[model samples]
Target chain A: MSEVREPQSDERLQMPSDPYSVPLDKIDVAQPHLFANGDHWKYFERLRSEAPVHYCEDGFEGPYWSVTKYDDICHVDSSHNLFSSEPAIVLADPEEDFELEMFIAMDQPKHDVQRKTASPVVAPQNLKVLESTIRERVCTILDSLPVGESFNWVDRVSIELTTQMLATLFDFPFEDRRKLTRWSDVATTDPEQDQSIVASEEERRAELIECLEYFGKLWHERAGNGGGSDLISMLANGESTKDMVNKPLEYLGNLVLLIVGGNDTTRNSITGGVLALNQNPAEYDKLRANPALIPNMVSEIIRWQTPLAYMRRTANEDTIVGGQTIKAGDKVAMWYISGNRDEDVIERANEFLIDRPKARQHLSFGFGIHRCMGNRLAEMQLRILWEEIVNRFDFVEVVNEPTRIFSSFVHGYAEMQVVLHPKKA
Target chain B: MAKITFIEHNGTKHEVDVDNGTSVMNAAIDNLVPGIDADCGGQCSCATCHVYIDSDWVAKAGSPDDQEESMLDLNPERQPNSRLSCQIPVTDELDGLVVTLPEFQF
Candidate 1:
């Protein structure tokens, strides 16, 4: 990827086609099983070119239509009535549902009201109130890192800040915050599907009962206190209409979503930005030389990494998209992975240009109604994060090819061997 | 300079003089008016700068558009007067506008 390909500028860069015509089974990178193999982008590129609106019928991880075009993604994402986040957001399959419910998964009036319940916490006024607290925590995490020593930046830097932020949001005891982070990551990334984190597949229902009982106590206690310092307190006080009666699982699920949803996704963006910078010395130096550019650089990194790869949506009605008709009840996964590199909207789309005027315009957070609710908070975390990292680290590099998590939905680095050379003490 | 009045949830009114072409949200924040966050840096994304408009100035501010209306679904108490301050441009017509901020936007 380092060697920039040169061609006549007149022609737009496009996905190559011979590969898209291949049978889904025969297609490279089609199986979720191959997610570990890496090089998934090769197949993504093929499909993006030949069948921008192609369906993956023999999908091992998905049989849904993969919508890769930027505009098409916007169309599907913006049309809340046409495509519902309900029926779930991940591309699991025909029959599994998680115990959690989220504003991101609800549509219209319900999604609207549900979003209000948590919006106060994310609203600028609220987040700004927490800025100093967040910065202190960010500094605490950074201050704890061994100076001039190699460490897993992902664990110490990315995860810690976000997890701690979630802890503050839940007002959970700090020592136990990591447990919440783990539960969140596991609940979301478990592609095995329909299995509660608490139980074996054999007694899944029984296990959920136990898990729910334990969590329900906390939910009620928080609600019992009638809301407190954290978001749980806010939701407990905010009115949910007649439709939301006694749904502890849904309420608890929302807590989980807020934690992981805001946690790893932005965490990955930070790690990805450092990895990209460390790999591209010129870009890093470009940033260090112009500290005024940190905010824009953060945007570029999010555009480039697009930490949360794709979110699934089910069609409420049949609609034609990208020259293909999607039947009602069919599943469609909008791969943010492909959309970010889209050639049409972005010139030299594959390349990361730090000064790109439109870096903030990327659909990485998504577009329209269901666009990420935590986007501002995520940016606040990332911007201040990069401000610190760019000032402290003189040099950083990836020592090994990072191993990715197994799930197709989460494109995250499990282990990134990194070496960070500290700034002169 | 233009006059901008901020009505607090408790019914306290703090008025400010603002330059033309500034966002009502920006003017509120610039004047240190109690409750505007402007978190997204005025990207029209974060709904933190929400305010309820005084009906007298509704014509000056006009109605919330689809984008603003949709975002309002995320505000704490939905009122017919709900509008994201960032979306309401501070034009000459809005010179005498009165806006109320929720007790707390968070």
Candidate 2:
């Protein structure tokens, strides 16, 4: 695994921060610092106007194409046959020794089958069953927050609510719920990009192994228990996945997928909504005036945050997207973050509008088969949180600038200080 | 013009006059019909526009193509007559076309 790790190039380290100052060919949006500093928007804007289907030959994660336009992203994402999601979905190749098999990074028959087996847990029908439980949890978390003092909303509200929801989904032990949050952070955290979560790749691997062993015990207890609706039981009993327990790595891989899928994405969005509303007070006022806009505001927040920045797909055959000829075996990134802000598709795309029409029609949840399975679940959680919030607090005020996450993959905040103002009776 | 009828999951009916080339999904969305989301617009990518073709109109509305099938197959709530409304183009073959929208888009 150490031998497979590529050393960072000095040129990449010294690359200019300004998008316009650098040559068109020198633009590499994959750099983690750009996103960390909130400087990615200008870079993507330049690429969208000058070179929508831009390519970087010498990136830290090797060469990859950036699909920046909204329609072009749809084309790449929908054409599953032309571009395959194999090996991994991030720009960096998976460690050869620790390669894990998960459905989102797979194509065709296998992807469809495994996804079908696990998706029922978060399906709309099941979400209806989970709604009341989620509201109850949301209320408790909100009620516990200190109203007068400023606190890190990311840790207190965002992380706590999402972590609790994930525990309920897996029917996991309520006491060890924060373990889910740690594993989720470790799963997506690249030590090269951010060492705050884990000191090194070896540490990341060790923590994930610990997570596998923990869930393995649960799998054993539930494998033959006649199939409960919880995710672990479904995977343990489903026809295609029942044998997954025998394959430790495969079992671990699916566990990480479900964990991170349910965790980091929603956690960041929850935090992002508070920050967005604070930044645009008029929109916040709109939300306050009519709490009915909560559902629509949820969609707008997801689009604005775009929790997971982009998904990487390797081209199976030669393809043409946005007038550029992408060769076979090229890495293509469908930049959902950029696409969600595209002016051509989304009118007045830059501004944050809670009442935006056709709010659900955004690329935040990528289109095609690999589209987010937990989208409805995420929306429900946000909807319920905001609904309860409006019923209680006058405002969830962002007291200071947020410290953003240091990864391009997880587009979110690390910490945000916010003070809750109670509604005047 | 083709007259299309969309039935909600609760049995409410909506009838609209659609242009010859417009899709059933667009017709529903254009007329402010409650059920259809059409998240991917007219593209057959997302299965949000899923609808059940009436038994009488099944033959004329036609079966899903390969792309549509790939999307629809992922849906757990899909029924025998399930078709993505985005894939069905409105025409004058039979004016009184009716399709039922699923309770949830999934």
Candidate 3:
């Protein structure tokens, strides 16, 4: 099957400047340019009102249904039997030549078996052991931040902390921890947009292949050593996934899934929280008044940021959602980012209030069986980071507009310049 | 204190004494009960801690509010006695509470 390609010409990302005044027929929320230019909020809001279960006949990634309403998204995401996660979980189809076989893209018994293998990593017992280690590393990263000087928070704080945590989770080589972040970006990035991420599709595959080779060595070593509690060891030792070594593509796919799953959600939320607090100073003040609210504030931040914009599913059979008929084989994209802001489900849906009731009732970690297994781990990381931040920095001042990732899938920052001002004792 | 009996989908029973004011979700998760994932850390989101209240305890378990009801609607297996364990607070008035874990909490 031929996949939809992003427009790469001179007018590649050109979008209507006025989102509010654009004709309803012209709206395509899947356009990466809308997100890249930070112009999607109004467009999605318009879709929520005019067409909640909208269909895009001209989506860049081919025609796919956009489930923008919260209830509709829940219906689509929860009814996995009717809407399959197979083939792929994004608008883009798997490459015909090199299909990645991660469990999140699989359905039923297979998804459950492979998912159970990695579930122990985020088990409550393991988190108890990892908390102090995470807090210590967080404090070290925060203390090293240069006060009274503007720097890229993405690099200085967000990436550094999350990368370190990923390293710990995988027991990866501490010195080359940044590679995890790199592979994550490459996995989701479009080569057409930036050469720095990946110059071409071949290079993307080569880099990922190289990623598999490295992890492959780790898998062998861990398996020989009788396995352990780390994610790689768990996969290698788990009955369902042990033979993944023979299936290199599946191994690579699961590796990519774990890397991206463990990396993006928390890292982006870390940066987004800083930008959010700066954008909504009252919320920051509320946070400052009672550091006890850090835990709840963390959930609100994740809900508000919605790091992963959406997860796609293919309709297995004809179904009605939001009073719209969706036929079998139709590509369905559950817009978690839009659902996070659904006004009816979440009161004051657009605001950044930390004290909002039912703050965690959002679609950021998704819903149903495909719900993020690392959700509590992600929340704990953010909660601890903010706890440390409130005690130390009075403000994480955003100096300029953030450069957001061009992809519609990873709703995150590429560069956000900020300065941390220390609190007066 | 309230004594809560959690029966896994396979019929494994874990009876624990939870302090009044603790949530049934936390009680299960804290005790390492097998069925309740509580992936959201007891948040009303991610309906992973869904349970079926015994008919005897249904009235005492109380009906779900608007938010909890909205979440429960997403669970296909949800029944009239269904309640999100996270939303149910343990209290002395309901000393012997029984919540049967669903086969699928996803």
Candidate 4:
């Protein structure tokens, strides 16, 4: 046993893979490279079918329980007592001691407060007002792309969407939106992999101070004048969103939550959706044919893309799931990437069928109370963008294979070059 | 046209006349009832369109399928009365029925 394990450890240490290296074969809930294999959908199809709640010792994310089945994931999400989102969701925070961090690392009573403060801003009703602007932003960004010319779709469009939308909501200056997006990408999505992030921690910290100062200004303005408006005002002023969470820790946590929430998740979804459509022209054509199906199509795209692939839940007291005993404080990762394609849950799960009758039933936004607050807004953005794409662009095609971001937490592309030409009416 | 009554959680009743094919969720959305949110636009994923059917009408409305039953587990205050409004397509049998909406669907 010693000899066998010794060689494996030696081999791993001897040859390090990519910076954000993830072995696609393992049942890691965090692997972003599952798309590398054509079997991305069914990489764990057999495991999900077999164990449902199997533990993976081979996971780069480490020995966390992989909850792959539909019901189990929902069970873990809802029962916050048993499966806590705090301590850490992705893995142990790479930056062990960073002063600029917040209470996103804390559990209940705390997570509840932060989530509450941030939820309303991204809520469905508020998002409805931003739909037209989101559409206009998508078009304005897309229109800038040259006809039949290749450009990085992820960099140009997806990243920009997240940057601009988040900035608009936060009322950040327009010019600084992209900077905020880049800083957010480095800060939340594993600062370890991006060396540029490591070298520029000081710069990132400085910008963060600037942002905090700006927000501080907003808080004072609201506190004194009381505009009776803006998310910043409500957050700086609103009373407890949850019963036990009226503290200032959550207020700071709310900042981290809002930044990550507003940025990466939607960024990946947009890039993934566009790539999926370009790859499957038939699915794109189906969407083009009805146009009315844009809503359902949006659902399908989210499922297929599975952005923010997996969320980590720390085990509370010792418990059993899928017949496996989980020790207290054990990290259990609910692999939404796998569950989205669970054959038991979705028929022909691997195939990207826009017209799939039950495609809206994906767990990408998650289940239970932790279900994404930004879901409606995400769909609204997707629907309008698709509608506009079909109506405006005569032809859009992937001109080069997309270069994926080297992050285990966010399953997304960093760059995907494409060509677009206006349709001749 | 079919007549429907919505008995809200606050003990308020809303009545709407609808065509034969619209769903209970659709009716609430169409009539702009204060509580009902068809967030998935009448899909079963969001239990936002949840309603509590009258005990006497559970049989008429039948139980939700396995998928919907699973979805409802994620919703709050799950009782025997809970059902996804999208699964219950509007029909003649559902006419003059009363359903109640949960307080927080977000």
Estimated TM-score for each candidate: 0.78, 0.98, 0.84, 0.76
Against the true structure, whose DockQ is highest? 2
Candidate 2: tens digits of C-alpha lDDT, residues A1-425:
11144676767743456899999998889888888889999999999999999999888778899999999999999998999999788887877788877999899999999999999889999999999999999999999999989999999989999999999989999999999999998888876644457788888899999999999999999999999899999999999999998888888888989998999999999999998999999999999899999999999999999999999999998888899999999999889999999999999999999999999999988999999999999999999999999999999989898999888888999899998899999
True lDDT of residue A172, candidate 2: 99
Supply candidate 3's per-residue lDDT for A247: 97
- Model 2, range B15-91, lDDT digits (tens) per residue? 99999988899899989999888888878988999999999999999989888999999999989999999998889
Candidates by DockQ, descending order: 2, 1, 4, 3
How should the candidates be ordered by TM-score, best one leading?
2, 3, 1, 4
The alpha-carbon lDDT assigned to residue B68 of candidate 3 equals 71
Residue A257, candidate 4: C-alpha displacement in angstroms: 1.8
What is the Å distance of residue A84 in model 4 from its true position? 1.3
- CA lDDT of each prediction against the hidden true structure: 0.71, 0.90, 0.85, 0.68
Q: Per-residue lDDT of A155-271 in model 3, one digit per residue for the tens?
A: 888889888998999999999999999998888887766524778887888889889999999998998567788999988888888899999989999988988988887889999
After superposing candidate 2, which stretches have Cα over 4 Å from the reference? A1-3
Residue pairs that clash (backbone atoms under 3 angstroms), model 4: A394-A423
